[model samples]
Structures are given as structure tokens and as C-alpha cells.
Target: MRTHNQRDAPGLRDSPSEVNGKGTSGPEPNKRRGIRGKIINALSPISVGKAKIKHKKKNEEREESKPITVDQIRELIHEKKLFEAGQHLLMMEKASYAEQSKEGKGAARSEIEAAYGLLKQEALRVIKTSVRMAPVNPELLQNTVRAIAEQVKEDKTAALEKANVLSVRPRLWKEAWKEMIQESVTERMQVPPFDGVEGLSATAHSFLHMGKAMKDDLITVVQHIKPHYPNDFRVCCVYAECYYQCFSSQLEGIAQFELGSGDNALLLTWVQNIYPNEIKKHRVLEKELEEANLGTLLPLKQIKHLEETYLINELESLKRCLARCLQMEVTRWTQGREPEKLDGHFHSELSIDAIQAVYGGQKRAKDITPDLGKQIAPLLLVELLTFLQSYKKELERFLKDNKQRQHFEATVIANINNCLSFRTHTEENTMPGQNAVKHQISVVLHEIQNAGFEVLLQGLFQELQALFKKFTQKTWLSCSSIMNEIIGCASNHMATLRTLKEPFRQAIVEKIHLHLVREHIARLVKKKVSLRSAEQQGQLSQVIQTNAATLHAFCTENGSNARWLEPVLPRLAEIIRLQHTDAIMVEVGGLASQYPDISKKHLAAILYFKGNLSTSETRGILSVLDIHLSATLPPTSLFSDIKLS
Candidate 1:
């Protein structure tokens, strides 16, 4: 009727309030429309498009006032509904942004900006917590990573579609997430808990525990986080690098501390024995880490410096241990305790302890690196050599005052065995200075053996000297008591001499034989004996021959294998007893051929004792050496040491 027709009336151009004097009739207007009018509106294309556009406009206007807020973003992110939050953020940004030619919706655009900012901050925190905290939430990480990807996509869309009206540019939140790994690892490694393991220092335990924690986390990355991430991320290597850097820094800090030998050894064990062998080369992590191309956790130079420090510390500790062992051994000896016996041989623990201390430290060093072992063995060998010298010196001092002690010879024998044991062990090892060290040890052994022999035969020299002063005189030639007394004095020392082992036993006994024989010859030199006739010479030669035979028999019987000494006295007796110059010349030539070291003083003594050879004959006898002995003496050093004067 008039209602529908009047709405489209040509003169209805006025404002609604003024044009509608029938405004109160609007409720009645719907009732006036019929089925025919509704059908026409629904079927008409223009009216359909207009109605759809009007409906969409009304919904958007309502939504624009309170489109996705910062609080909503915070709640979704907190709930870890990251994909959903990212979707809603995209929608809100698209809604708030104006077209490419116009500025974005003012307050709504600002809200979108705040929401994304909150997202970036929370997402970074999530990444960090995933690394730093335990029991990683895989789903949360997956969602966060996905959401970051979505943000990247949305930012690209925003830049391309609404370039001029862009509210916030791309942040590339994933890169920020990766960077968080370093900061996360640093904080986590700084405070690893004590593992309560036995025999490890706090620093060492910390290192071990942190390393384990890192490995465990990296395993998580390999199994869970890495598989979920795309290949381009190389998430495993990324995690590994962060852990390595943090753990390496921690190692650097631990290395700087003033550590004990045990601590250093433990550190060496971890750095060398465990880190490279067990961790980096682990079964599961090996291939991945190799591809990752992370070099050794420590640089070569840093590791080298650490190895040197550990070696020096170990050597110092070994030196201190040797000194302490020597001190304890001295106390045991001073207390007069019979040295502990092993296998019917006198024994002491000093050598055993010293060997163990040095090689044990060497083993510890080598455990860190073979190069470290090379550095330490020679240094330790030197320390042991020095200890041996100290050992000899101390024993010498002790022997002077304690010769009467019942355990004295036992102590000396035990120490000699100690040196032998040490030398044997030293030679067995292949080290830089092993041969030289062994030689030095042998020298110490020789000195110690002489020291003991000197103590055992202490006062016999004075007695023998007194009696030998009467040599070549009337009373001495008649009496056999002088030689018998010398034999008796020497025989008393032979009891202890048999207790030592072969080489040393024979060496000591020969030293005694040399002492007696040398004294016999030295007495001749001192007396300047020149027998005038055959009867006196025969008497002197007979007495010397009898005494020399007795001495040789005794010396050979009691481990003195010095047959060279045997011929020395017998030949001297033959030379002295001879009256003919040719026979004497033959003997002198034989002696010179056997002992090239026989000097002019020795020939003078022998010739003067013969009393048969004229001065020219003596000169000719000495001339045998010009051809037999060169300016460079032979290596046989026996007679040069005889001291004929």
C-alpha cells in the first residue's frame, strides 16, 4: 500500500528524523511487507549483494573495537597454544591494517603491535627455558617453533600486501630463539650441582656433572628437538655449539684454580680420557657432531698449556713424595729396625715407592695425553736420580755413627738392593733419559757399595798400616805374624760380605783384596826397600809369595772373581824374587802387556824392591811401556789407581 511505495517516493530526500513524520510507524512498516516483496528482495542480485555487504560491515565494526588484544595474545602464548595465537594475530593485524595506500586503523593497529611484541618476548623466554630447565616440553617447543614460522610468513604477507601501511616489520623470531641457546647454556652450566662422587674434588665433580648434563640435553636435542626442526635449522649443531662453548668456558675457569695433584689428575682424566674419547666420539652423537664440524672443545694451544701445567704439578708432587719417602726410610734406619726382608734378600720400600710415585704420576699424565707422558717421564727420572744421591749421602752420614748397630749391614744391603731395584725398573722403561738415568743410578749404587765396604772394614786399614810399616825390615821378613794379622783383620769382615747378591758381593770382596794387595805394594814404596843380596831378596820374595798365595786363595774362595788381582801379586813376587835382568825384563814386559796402565812410579817401586836390577836395567824395563802403552792410556784402570808412592 502507501508504506512500501512512499519509502521509494521521489520527494523523500530529507533527513530521516525530518522526513519521517511516520518514524513511529517503522514497526508497522515490516508488517506491511508481504511474501511477494521478500521474494523480490531475495531474488534480486543487487539487493542480495547490498544485504551481504551491510551484514559484513556491521560485524567488522563491532570486532574492530576489541579485536585480538595484548592480553589475549599473552593468554594464548602462556597456554602454549602458539599456533592458534599466531593465527589470531595474523587475523587481527590484517583487520587493523588499512589498504596499501592508507594508514592502518589507529588504536586497533597499536593493539596489534602490542600483541606481537608480547609474543616475541614470551617466545624467546620459552626458547631459553627449554634449554635451561629439565624435562623439556616437546609439544610446547614444536608449537613455539611453528608459531615463529607463522610470524615470518605473516610479516612477509604484511610487507607485500599492505606495504605502505605496515604496523610492525619482521623480527625473524627464530634466529632470536637460536641465540637464546647460548645465554641459556651459560646460565645453566654456571651452577651444576655436586654429584657427591667419592675422591673427586668439588671442581672436578662440577666439571663432570656439567658435562653429563650437557650430554643429556644434547641427546634430547638429537632425539626430539632436532627431528622436529627442519633441516635448514641444523638444530642439533646449534645446540651442541652452545653447550660446547659454555662447558669450555667452565673448563677454562676450572683450569685457572690452584688445584692439588689429585684434582689436576682428575681434570686431566676428564679432558683427555673422558671428553674426547667418551663424549665427542660417543656412539649416538659422533656422526652428527662430526658433520657439525665443531673442533675440539679446547684449542690446541689452550690444551697444550693445560697439559704442561698438569705435568709440572704432577712432577712437583712426585718430587715431594720421593723426599717424604726418603725421610721415612731414614727414620726407619735410624730407629735400627732391621729392614724388611723379601725372598731371603734385604729389602726396603723406598725404591718401590719412588718408582710408583714417578710412573704413577706419569700414567696420570699420559692418561691426559701421550705428549704429556713424554714431557713427564724424563723430569720424573731426574727427580728419582736426585733422590738417589740424597739417599747415598744420608746413608753415608748414618754409616759413620751407626756402624756398631746390629742392623747396620742389613740396612746397607737393603739400600743397595733398593738402588738395584730402581735401576732395573728405570732401564726397563723406554723414556727420554732412561739410559742416562740408569747410568747415574749405577754410580749411586757404586758409591753406596763402597760406603758400606768402608764401614765394614773401618779400622782394619790403621792396623794393617801399622804392621806394614815394618815391611822389608829384619823383624818383618822373619815374622809371618804381620801377614797373618792382616788376614785375620780382613777375615772378620767377610761374614757380612757374603750376604749381598753376586755382582755386588764379588765387587766388595775384590775391593778388599785390592785394599790388602795395594797396601802390601804401598808399604814397599814407603819403605824404599832395596835388598842388597840374593839371600835377603829370596827371604823377602818368599814371604811375599806365601802371603800373596794365602790372600789370593782367600779372595777367590769368598766370591772374589778378580783373577786379574791374583796374577798381579804373584807376578810382582816373581819380579822381586828374580836375580837375572833378562828374566826380570820378561816379567816386566809381561806385566806391562797385561796392565798397560802401570806407570813409572809402579815400575820404580817394583825395580827398587827387586834390588837386583841396576838403574839402566830399571830404565830399560820401564822402556817396555813406551811401545806397550801409548800417550793415550788403555781403558784398564787398575794400576793407575794403585798410588805406588
Candidate 2:
């Protein structure tokens, strides 16, 4: 064993050769140990642990100091800008884009550059902010993203307002809708990659509530604004649209109460008032007004009142107006005549106009009574017509008395007829050997037809033969008498036609006017009854709908005079229908007790059916019989199966 000093092992720093077994100290000992030993010692577990700790600390520091890769920076920037980094990635990673990138090769390389540039700017900003703040808080990032979204929305709204495209209210409505879309877009952007699909789908449901609010506001505005501008066409259109919306909003309101309000009285009156003013007082508006059937809005009681009042007014007006017009016209006519003012030569010639004037007023006065000729005295219209006929006859007699003029006119007519009857042969038909007779009958017939003497021409050939026979019998008497008789017959026929002209024309015109008046009143009554009868009993309502129209028509015509004639037509129709039904019923059974009235139709029907007449034959008999109905029958079958009754 070595001494204590040897045991102490020479101090490494003090001596180089103090130790015997350990060899050298300090640098020489460390060198003699060999690099492998040192290296092995350095790699021992304890040393390795200390070195690993130090190396880890150094690596963390280096990572913190190095610049972030462009991709990571871009990701951060995208998250801050759009608030939807993953969604953006997904959009960029579309299958189409990916395929294009794979297949297009270098062609789409510029798009990639653009994408990188965009990402780079975004990432740079995010990074710069993150650095300034030292660390990025998640809440701050979210708030930043929301603020950006708000700014984008504001920008879009500003742009729309700047455009000044639509009217203010409509534009506002559109902007509201656009804001909703922007919100949805912003929501979708906010969704993370994992939550994106569900978030988008959920956001769509918000639009339903939004849509309802929009419609409600629009309707409220229209309703509020409409009444202020009643005559404005635009306002009217809007009001109508809004009303339609309200109507559609509630189905029950549309169906029950609204529709049953029946005619739109106010609208009808407005149209009636305004249309005439706009169309320049056209006479055709009268017909249009009638067709529009504004009276359809009136109740039955109102219609009856209108009919009575209007009938009185129209008759009163016509009477006064006609009398005044006739007096004026006659005065004008009388002005043309002058008197010689000599004793006997001052004979007054009765003028038709003077007669018409005197008689017209009388006719109106006569109409005020029940009896036509006796009680009412003669109507001026009747007297005027009678006077005209008598005057024509007197004129004819005077013409005949003046034989020279009469004979001249007669001779002219006869010579014209004779010349027309004398047919000449054309050169083509006048060959030497051809002896054909020319037919002059057609030429004579044409001349007579042209003269408006068709009745005289009807017995053309026979009359001509008679004339020829008369010419041969007795020269003096035959020529004068036969010729005079022919002329007299023609003159008498012409005189009759002329005298009856005014009466016939007046009768027809009055009849037509009455018919139109009756038809209009009938329609008015039908409309009035229809409105009331909608809620009435079915059978009674149907009767009103069906026969009331026809009955009302007659009531409208002739007023009190028609009261007698009015009931006759319906009674007749009822009698006919019951008669036909009873007749057909006879084949199976007896007539129903419902129809109890006796009439010509009933009797005829009983006779025909008992005799077993065919349907066609029965109809023919009824038509010829001209039977009127007096009552109606029940719904009991006339045939066994009722036969589509």
C-alpha cells in the first residue's frame, strides 16, 4: 500500500509525476486515457441526460427565433381575414381545381401564383398583428373576423345605395334581403372545417322567418299608403295587389263573406261615372252600362222602385219633348207656304206637318186614359197616321180628276213597258234560214222589277194576254176601260202602300223600342232577384231565377197597360208545360193534382195522350193548337223512369 501522500494521489493541478499506479495527472492523464475512453465516458447515461436537457433548451429557442413557413403564415392570415381558414382550404381544394392542377400542368401555374400572393399578404398581416400583441388570443381572432365581416356588409350596402337603382322602399326591401344573404355567407365563413356543413344548413332556416317579416311589412306599407291616393292608378294597382294578398292570407274570409258580398257596388258606380267622361260621351256607353248590369247590385225592393220611378220619368219626358219637337218642326214646314191674299185665290192648303203637330199632342193626352179611342180620345199619333192616309187618297183623286196629266203619266208607263217587251234579234241570230222567236218576257220582267212594281209584274204573262184580248174585242171601250182599270189597280195598290207607310214604320219602331226596354228591365229584375235569392229556398229561388226573368220583362214594358198583358205569357207557358207533362203522363197514369187550371193546352194534351200520339206528332199538334199554360205541375214522373226529366 502507498503512504498517505501516495494514497492522496498527486494533485492534478500541483504535479505531473507524483502518482505511481495512476501515472500522470491533469492533461497527461486525460490524454493517456485515449479519445475512445473520453468519448465513451462523455456518452455515459449521466452525461447524456445533462447534454439532452441542454440540447432541448437550445432547439426550442431556435424554433422561436426562425421565420414561419409561407404556408403557416398564409393559414393564419386566412383565418383572420375570412374567419374560415379550413373552409377556404376546402374551397381551394375542390376536385375540379385539384384535377386541373394535376392535369393542366404548367398552364394554370399562374393561378397558383395568384393564390400564393393572396395567402402571403393575408398571412403577413396576421403575423404582424400577432407579433405586436406578443400572442394571439382566440377570442380576439373571432372578434376581428366578425368586424371584417361587418365592414364587408356595410360596403355592399353602400354600393347598392350609391347605385340608386330602385325606388327607395323597394330598394330598402332588397337591401334587407341582401343583408340576410350576407349574414348567411358570414356564418358559413365562421364555421370550422368539421362544423361547416351543419352550420350552413342550419342558417338556411332563418330565411323563412325573415321572409314572413318582409311580406308583412310590405303589406302594412301598402295598406297605410293606399287610401291617400284614391285616383292614382299606381296607388290603385298597389292597393289591389295588397288586397289580394290579404284575401289570400285567410281562406275562410275569401270564400264565405267576401264572395257573398255579391256585386261590387262602389266599383260599378265608379266605372259607370268615369268611363263615359273618358270615352267622350259615346252613345255606345249606354249599351255598355246596361251590359255591366250595375242594377245587379240592387235588392229586389230597390229594383221595383227604380222601375216605377224611371217609367214615370221617361214617359213624362218623352211626352213633353215629342210635343215640343213636333210643334217646332211643323212651324218650320208651314213657313214655306204663302197665301195669295186674294179673295177666292187665298185658299188654304192643308199641310201634313200642320196635321202632324195638331194630332201629336192629342195622342199624348189620349195615352193618359184607359180606353184608346173613346175614353182617351184619339192619340195625336193615331190621328196623324189616319190623316196621312186620307190625305194621300184625296191627292190621288185630284190627280185622277186632272185627266191630261194623269193620262200622260199612264201613257209613259205603258210605252215604256211596250218598248221593253219588244225584243230585237242580234246579227248572229239573224241568219237568213233561221226563224227563231226572240223571248222578250225577261226584258219586260226586268223593267217592271226595276220600277219597284213587283206585285204588278207577278201576273205578267196573264196580264199581257188579257190586254191583247181586250184590244181586239171593242176598240173604244176595250182600250180605255182595260187600260184605265190596270192603271187604277196599280194606283190603288200604290196609294194603299203609301198611306200605310208611316203607321207601319211607326208601329215597328215603337215595338222594337218596347222590346229592348222590356229586355233590359227583365235582366235588371233577374239580377236583383238573383242577389236576394242566393239565400232563399231552392225551389222558390229557382222559380225566381227562371220565370221571373221572363215575367219581369213584360212588366217593364207598357207599364200599367202591360199589367193586363204581362201575366198572360207566364200563365200560358205554365199551361203548356203542364199540358205536355200531363199528356206524356197519360201513358203511365193520371195527371198530378198540382196543375189544376183549365186551358186549351190541357184539353188538347188530354185528347192527344188518350189517343196515344207519337212525341213528334204531339209536338206538332201543340204548336198548331197555340195553347197557353195557366199553372205548373209537381216533380212526379210523367214517364215510368222519368226519362231524364
Best by TM-score: 1
Deviation in Å, model 2, residue 193 alpha carbon: 74
Q: Count the backbone clashes (under 3 Å) in each candidate.
A: 0, 8
Candidate 2 wrong stretches, greater than 4 Å = 1-307, 336-645
What's the true lDDT of residue 613 in model 1?
66
Q: Write down the TM-score of every candidate.
A: 0.64, 0.16
lDDT of 1 by residue, 502-615 (tens): 677788788777777777767665545678788887877787788889888888888787777667777877887888888887887788777777777887776776666678
Error at 418, model 2, angstroms? 34
Compute the lDDT of residue 353 as modeled in candidate 1. 85
In angstroms, the error of model 2 at 254 is 31
Highest-scoring model, lDDT: 1
The worst-scoring run of ten residues by lDDT in candidate 1 lies at 24-33
Candidate 2 residue pairs that clash: 359-380, 363-379, 363-380, 571-629, 572-629, 575-629, 575-630, 576-629
* TM-score of structure candidate 2: 0.16
lDDT for position 82 in model 2: 36
